[model samples]
Target: MNSVKKIAMLMCIGLPAFVHAGEAMVKWHDFNDYRDVRATNQAKGSYHKQIASSIEKHAIKLAEQLPKGYKLNLEITDVDLAGDVSYRGANEIRVVKPIHFPQLTLNYSLMNETGKEIGKGNDIKLKDMSFMDKIKMGRDESFYYEKRLLTEWFGEEILPKIN
Candidate 1:
């Protein structure tokens, strides 16, 4: 088969699952009040939104585990990314160290197929102190540490409540 035909066939087979996958509702509190969300050298305006997008995307991926008609809602109150920003001669860079672990504070609720809340929490704090020691496949990916932290939390805290 031609390359275009092969690609089209693959997309046709995958589209339904992609469209039907569950998505989480993610909301962020005022970023201005957060502890840390610095993005290398970019201004706060652009980087903050990117950070939120990354988080929301990760949440949606996690939500795919929910059964049909179930939903996960997350309201993030704070975000402290895994690194501290420092200047390296004329350029600014993020320095990753053990002390500067990734942290997230949020509230979450899990709803059932009937729209009833089965599990919920307020001001839940998530942190990865041993982020560097863990095994991660995508080191160059955006928000690598933060996504890892969320993945761990979803599996431990959220998945258990559903079962």
Candidate 2:
């Protein structure tokens, strides 16, 4: 009876791990800017962390939108915000008005419970191409542009298939 008790205890401890092994969720790893020019300032560094956090939260919510055993793996390759700011002088910077277009590149894939690949997308770019034509970006607050871009992408790309 001692051997039986030990076996049962082992199973109880290990069963949950086995079950969660195939659990589905967002697997975002080592997300960082791949562009050659990188920001060195403290503000930009902080902003990048914030951006990553937002993406992680959104990805989790996106995962919950799908059925069980469906995992979405995403890698953010690049991030270019709406506007370009150039230093005009010693203490001033000139903002490029017409070129403030938000863009993001991601390599993503969807996998089922058994690790079967349902779909995949590489070099997927999410960009607001109609920025100059109709909608004018009026706000200059933090994360306004990037949050909008991610929200739109989640709504259009991920929500449809899940629903």
Highest lDDT: which candidate? 1
Residue 161 accuracy (lDDT) in model 1: 77
Q: For residues 1-163, write the lDDT of model 1, one tens digit per residue.
A: 9999999999999876764455599998888899998777888888999998988988998888777777899999999999899999999899999899999999989898789999899999999899888877855888999888889899998788777
Candidate 1 ranges with C-alpha deviation above 4 Å: 1-20
Worst 10 residues of 1 by lDDT: 14-23
Q: What is the TM-score of each candidate against the true structure?
A: 0.85, 0.60
Q: In TM-score terms, which candidate is top?
A: 1
Q: How far does residue 121 in candidate 1 sit from its true spot (Å)? A: 0.4
Query: What digit string (tens of lDDT, one per residue) describes model 2 on residues 1-163?
Result: 6999999999999775554332224344343534421233346567567667766775675566566677878877777766665555553332535556778788877777777877778888887866556553666645555566766776787656544
Would you list the C-alpha lDDT of every candidate in the order shown?
0.87, 0.63
Give the runs in model 2 whose Cα sits over 4 Å from its true position: 1-44, 88-98, 132-141
